[model samples]
Target: MSKSGITVNDLLKFSFISDPQVSPDGNWVVFVKRTIHKQKDYQSSLYVMNIQTRELIPFTQGDNRDTSPRWSPDGKTILFTSNRSGTNQIWKISFHGGEAQQVTFFKNGASQPVWSPDGRSILCTTSLKENQSIEETESDAKASKEQEKEPEPYITTRLKYKANGQGLLEEKFSQLVFIDLETGEKTQLTEGSYHHNNAAFSPDGKRVAFSANRSEDPDFTMISDIYELDLNSKILTKLTNSEGMYTAPNYSHDGKKLSILGHNMEYKGATLTRVWTLDLHSKELICLTGDWDTEVNDVAINDLATGAGSPGAVWTANDDGLYVLASERGNTHLYHIGLDQRITTVAGGKRQIYAFGLDQHRRQAVIGVSDPQIPCDLYHVSLDSRKETRLTEANQHWLLDKQVSLPDEINFTARDGLSLQGWLMKPVDFEEGKKYPLIVEIHGGPHMMYSNSFMHEFQVFAEKGYGVLFMNPRGSHGYGQEFVDAVRGDYGGKDYEDIMDAVDYVVEKFNWVDHERLGVTGGSYGGFMTNWIVGHTHRFKAAATQRSISNWFSFYGVSDIGYFFTEWELKTDKLDEPDKLWKHSPIRYVNEVETPLLIIHGEEDHRCPIEQGEQMYVALKHQHKPVKFVRFPESDHELSRSGKPKLRIDRLNEMAEWFEEYL
Candidate 1:
């Protein structure tokens, strides 16, 4: 009884898959299954699948989110985090099947549960206020007293005081915690005003390695160094130099070395992440992908896979090398890195392998993949035979009756002779000789890549009889480091040309595309481009910009990453480059915009801020140009990807109608 194609509300029917954890013996895989709850919110539960039979069984059916499933050493028990008790906490369940038992009762809740090598204790992450002790639990008598106090003014002298999703940064630190499985006793391992993440225990279970910024002025100096802590002596040793951003440290199987995924900030946020190995004994660090141009991580931009855990370096059983995901072109494929620095693709293709869990024996892996046709599904991949077995088809039921719009790859050359690539999805159920309007969709990150991964918005656009054109300009990832870093210091110069050229290529090559009925929309940097595109040219009949930056001068003070990102990307600070900022601002040319523009933004968006949308809307309205503004409350930078379900549907409807009206 469902529709033939994907609809705006059909998003509720799709199930998101993420964070697949393979059992030790490679017989089973437990992963997080996320589904929408009638637009109220999202529900995430853990599901276990037998590798051989491909039979999926419900493991945990928590009302709220239950994630981070890890197998015990002996594979008899599984440790995970759940929020069925109102807050996320550590929980354990036997492999044979039974009701889950709560393990940690931290007052702030605990997550990122990692079992120690001996399986006697578990290490997790928990946040604590400056004065609050880790001994504070839900059962503690002091918890009730502390909860009664009124909120105080936010006092902070630090530069980094806020994040996008999480509002004002509290005076809280995510410290390392250890909960004993046998005694059920919790102990705080690290203490400071800093946060530690990506923790892993040494093979002997005698030491712990984590990434943190323990340097002076942790806010101003954006350096994350790897550190090792001796569980016995309680002595912490700084492993890497405080020069660049480093994270996701993994200890070798033999406990002799550590593999890390990071970059030296050569291009700042646009820098390609490379794999590095640190000799724990010699304290020497080496980048294995130094000569390799491919970025070492999943760069595919996916909006479907919620809570998809990122893959890091997985040590081989023999300790000679490690397996990691590499982003080359538009696809994220698994690659093996040997000690000799040779990188070879193990499982690859056009699909986006977002999350992967290795077996460590070089035998097999469980990967979460999403392509243009598939949302996200688990697959069993053999590292030796290179055979792939489809594990779970979470969206197969409804997808079987839906007509998916498959994207055809497009490779074109920019006016400057720079090579560029993108995809164009024809209108679903198209008929020959019938002209259709084209909608140009731009991606936000300017730093992230938009691959052939399943995009919900793109599907909806194509389903509604509009040809969708999305391409990677110069600043997209999956390309080499130089191509991604090219947009820096040239926001609207060549990057704008690359986008325009893609549009030109599609319109010229396709006979069914109507040049007069063209529309454009994008968010963040893409939003900026949409605003810029309308101002620079009147080719687009309609335009919608979401969470966009209109004025560079005002954005420098309002945005969360405005100051440093301006310096890194724009190559100038507010004080030093006022004229340069004004020159690049789309507001400077707002009077030239003739297209019917719809300005969409999130009220709580600290990243781009709603003010940007307001400025663009006001400028256009003052000039009597066709413009409209719609703001989403209680949403931030992640509005399109993970915003409120109702708001996301509303956003899609707003854009589709806007295009349908003028185009």
Candidate 2:
């Protein structure tokens, strides 16, 4: 594995694995691993394993960040979420282990816990202020810490007032609380100014389900319904009336069904979340993956690991079926479905599972996955012989010595006759009439894809000799929902000829590539398609673009999803289309940019907002073209997936020194 190759210092020697769980009589599993330290930051912890003497252990240690775990329906405890007592709360411990016990002291702390099928209560989620409560935000943080008071002015009237990595706009709101494990008592449970989010609880623990938005202009409607409540008659109930976007929910273990995860914002935010269910005695509902056109979870993006939330579907202990995880085309798998709707798969291939758990008699589960040469771990599958096993090697001895690459899975045809999908790699030291230098990259959820994940910047651009590629062009998401709703109102049209027919079908089918030593990159909507491909094709020769947008008319008022993602991706109506958002602005094709670009961004990006890379570096340096920009500081739009590890290794050495100074 290591004949040298894969460096950004092998991404601080990789160690990822994420969330897994599986422990309610499936004999232990837990999970979350993370790593990266001496390059300063990112630690995470909590482990466990056992699943029949495959023993492992560690369950929470130093460097803070422990995460979501759960279990306890008499599996003898385990709850989780930690910030080691400095903030993010909820603790618990015990499945044959010792000391842990914190469990919520709330002054805006506490998080996702759940456990209540008669385990004497605990539901969680915190954030407060708007009609203030959690004991008046813990007595106004103990009277602003006994009086040094000066910093107070943030009063913005919400229409989504700020939020990228949660900055500014804090009239608070995250809600839901509960607690009581035999008299410790806490109880807030739903307040106002919106946001309730993924709560769960019902296999008869007297109700709790969640997901909120409660209309009356929740920032001009991105809907989000599904309610429930009733923890002894504080009654709430609204189980989705619909304009779309519900969320995680859960229930059905004989409580007669609920299961949620959502969509129906037709294609707003490129829709596809699917898997519905409801039926709690005919309050009806249905969508069980309405014709399953992929994406029921995991949108494969990977810079080593952060994913571990969606444990969505999971039902089958005779709830008549559902295991879920979907994605498709670029593989995410683990399927099942059935109460006669059928589906199937269970476990998958071509890798990238990203997270999973499931026990109390759903046989065996755990998962996490990854591929294109591993960087994610935790496995143990077996739900009736689907096999798997390898429970955690968190980056096996720094990926057994290195030289990685592995990609080649193409498929082309787009000069509008659609059918895309890409991936290429090839260049870590290959020979036989050599040529090389190609790059191409692009992927930032033009509905997210470039699948079979585990990308570390396409393996450090195939260890610098280049040849990368990467596609899924037509608004991605493993295709279908009319190809992820065909790039909403056609951003840079035909997703820029489906990524220039995937770089002209890999330079007319790869003859060791070269094609004038091209290059190109991407970030948010692949940095607005690498600033709409160096302002509409000067055919590559270097370009970068990260966290970009370049003016959907000043990104429809400075982006945090810029006022409804500029009226749902420029279908206009931002007050009757400012000339159709300056005709899909890449700053109106910056005087047709010629190439050597680079831009990058992030100064705390409010989702593609470093003023959309300072309006494409001031419209390509006021048209004298050849750009440069950079930015970063405290970063955002997840500066290349979870920033700061030496600014993600100095943003991959500033995109490998701007493509080694112009391709």
Candidate 3:
């Protein structure tokens, strides 16, 4: 390895691997590999690997993004979604290697392909016009092409009219459709004005289970229930009637039970997701991990690469158990849950398992893992022996000559007797008795945890001779439901204390930390906290907040999820207690700010809209406070994680320069 430190340019050299799916016979594994080209854009392609010999070969080639690969039931063919035909659609390719055949021809495109258990049909999701048939949609397209086009005005009717990345509402809903393999005929399985998500076929192939909000007031309520659609009768049965969000339903091997991940919303957005089993015969629901403290999904957020989506609760062959991923403390690990309600760790350590595919018969799995020093790679992990064999080294050459910083795990107690967990990364080239500037980094999703994964932003800060400290405060996942729920209705209360306590512990324990030259920065919820910290106390010399929320009063009506999110998180009825919403807003305390602050926001961000950053900037500017606002064009709430490659680098450089000038 070279003695030089890592730089922003080094990010393009790393490759990201995700969505590993093993063939039925356990002989081969197919996965998606993504790479950044000339720091312009990301290109993803599918690849296959031999289990025994560890030979890797590319299955799909080209610049088009190909992802979400799934093995056919017979193991003779592989199916995936690709945009090679100009738009994303399902395509099928033989396992022996050949040209992929297009399956769907929808104008809106298709995604999330799931094959039937008998391999006769494939189910996918595609957006369709509300209350309009496929023929009508095609007719409208033809007419629009023939006539001279004019700018159309947007007429708003729905409560939620715009999404962050999807732009303005189009009166379309995502519905399920199935394609017959033999006849190549397409049929719409479900239709509605509401959205359907996480659709899957039952083992018997007689019914389909999916989650949707079929209520009359779906725009006002955030409730979704699991439903089963009978193929022959065209009857939809509600399997769950809870008040919370329920989704990602998968049938057991025997088809007698269903496993799902959800919460009752008792704690609102901070509620921990648990695995529940439903008896199809008796209609009895039981939470399998009711007593478990960890959150039952992947919450390891990082900025290095795009993450492969999770396929919840992979069932075993005999239906006696299932494998699921859980986030605990600072790591996401695979766990096996038995029918008797016992939980056991299958493959786990101080590492993040981003994605995995299980072969129950062979007792082996193909998993995507990464750590502080490793970007990400695939490995063959044996469930019984707990032995992990490296299968791919996509980043070895780029990382070989780079000096990366590894985090030191930390544990400390909050003033309220709460145990908080975090990590500290020292400067890359450390010298004895040398004091370095400390930067306290906070994670978004007050519910998301800062886990043991590769973080490009943190490493960049460390390389610039700064000590980076990040932690899971009171509202973060991986902890129990109570701990995760503690931050709700108390936004800047205990959550703020937990972060400040973390900074205090680091400053007292580490002798090389310059307490006078401290910096604080975070995005989303963390951004709100950064604003809160500087407003409440001027402990840090400089602060940078990204995609933040300043005033909850205006946010309730303007944001996409504002109406419910403000009520649920702030624990106040916007109609009844408007003052409570303003009480927790950072803009309420802006006059107390004395530190040099930097505000970064995405112009198209709907989660925390640009108006939020604007409100704060205008207030600070009017008060003659030292603050500057930077706006990124065509970016959303995910700018730091999956925005354009060039913009992401510019964002990092901007933050570093702000701290370099102020701190």
Candidate 4:
């Protein structure tokens, strides 16, 4: 029998549950199940489970990967997208079992399918029409050159944020499409130069909702507003057109109101993305929770049978109420939010409540939770009985008596008196007196936070007998907006001091931490900090930076959203404010560096592209500093999570090995 212990390997193989859907009658639930196969070096698949029997079934499988599973309104079939057909295309399978059939035959791929209310059509978003590759005719070009002595006008594509994963900006545009279940005819609902993604059909089937940045803000990368489309006229109208990004829209069962995930631009970093409700007729928007800093992982817009307009909107099935995975006291937990807006804790500890969706009856829920030792697993959490039962036994057998250490959550004050949050882990068979090498792991985002979730990379450092320290320094979300925004324009100042203070605190408090053998590693913004730390101080013996930004001047135009995000964070838009962006750039202080560095980057990363890593590697080599570079091909900004799974594993292994060899 497999022991109920978490291991570093388990973190490396952790899976996720996303785009959860409940059947029409709420009797069955279907979701995507991801598993990382080290042998194959990939993660893939979709799964279904009966709410009543808890009998798990794998719906689609093969060499082709499948995901984003949604049940048809009548609940007799499952609609999903698969790469099994060479490219991602719509495919369906009977819930009763047997072979899955391909649905849409369009050359372009489709994803994120939603079933229309009457079950006559399926609503989804696709770049098929928008992605037409055009070749300039040689004859037309020759004629134009002879006639006007001017170059032929090739197709000029104008779109928002297309340079990332999907290379080459073709004439293609992302739009909403409706497919007839019987006739198989496809109707383009909304069309234009604007990109439409992550759409959902209204409960009444009269409208489809989506997120887009149609307004003429060349810097509109951050403004993703919610829009609703009229099915009859095929006209699109804006719903929530605020300054911030509005996403994850879900229609209430009654069709009178809509629930959506909203991120206000006023603040960034580890802040909360709240769940807001808007009345369709009145257009009155109401903020659902005051706990704004806490993340609302997934919300179900349920119209309860017992209470209709009870303010909090309680949905009870199997005697349980609405539950949300809320972060509190440094950890995420399942909580019951009552119709009266009263909150009660269900489960709390050092764990992550990644995702959850209601079952058919609305009584019990299929919950996905994970900790340091366990990868995510689905469970049935009863509302009335307060009982949680494990559902799928996916990779439970892989963990056999592997020992892992639980993190010691610690709070320390920076030199400037700002409080910082961190987690430390010692060796599994830790020795009290012997000083162990320490590794400081920094999280990216500068706006993102370092939560107490199961992280494989950090665990590996611990397993290799290195004391690990990771913290939410200035600018990390999870705290209030002011705290998160504190790091802006002050990058290497207080934030750097804060990290140095953390090392000071750990060294003083923990007698087992080796002061001489210190190392640092981080990705993206965290990677920037890692590079910055080594350049400014030689305290760390070694360092590894991933997908980092070495120079702000080049990053502004080279990265996808760097032009906007860099300006926003640095409070400067152009070279006129060169001093501001430069003061915070890591390359500015490379002359002070003494520690050896390893640079890892994704070749196609648009967020903080490969150039950032190249600049650092070139500078270090010129400075005669010991350095190395590892570039992953065919990867984007999400190399850690969505890059080639095997490559991600190797990336982590390489970082660990670098520190082990140098530190």
RMSD of each: 1.8, 22.7, 1.8, 6.7
Best by lDDT: 1
* Residue range 525-568, candidate 1, lDDT tens digits: 99999989998999999999999999999998888888788888
Badly placed stretches (over 4 Å) of model 4 are 1-27, 51-53, 128-162, 217-221, 268-272, 297-330, 334-348
Steric collisions counted per model: 0, 7, 0, 12
Candidate 2 — worst ten consecutive residues by lDDT sum? 135-144
lDDT of 3 by residue, 478-573 (tens): 888888888888999999999999999999999999999999999999999999999999889999999998989888887888888887788885
lDDT of each: 0.88, 0.81, 0.88, 0.70
Which of candidates 1 and 3 reaches a greater lDDT? Answer: 1
Q: Give the alpha carbon lDDT tens digit for every residue of 499-558 in model 4.
A: 899999999999899999999988888899998998888889999998898899888988
Q: What is the lDDT of candidate 4?
A: 0.70
Give lDDT for model 3. Answer: 0.88
Question: Candidate 2, 599: how far from true, in Å?
Answer: 25
The candidate with the higher TM-score, 2 or 4, is 4
lDDT tens per residue, model 2, 440-514: 888886787878878888888888788888888777888878888778888888888878888888898788898
Error of 4 at 395 (Å): 3.0
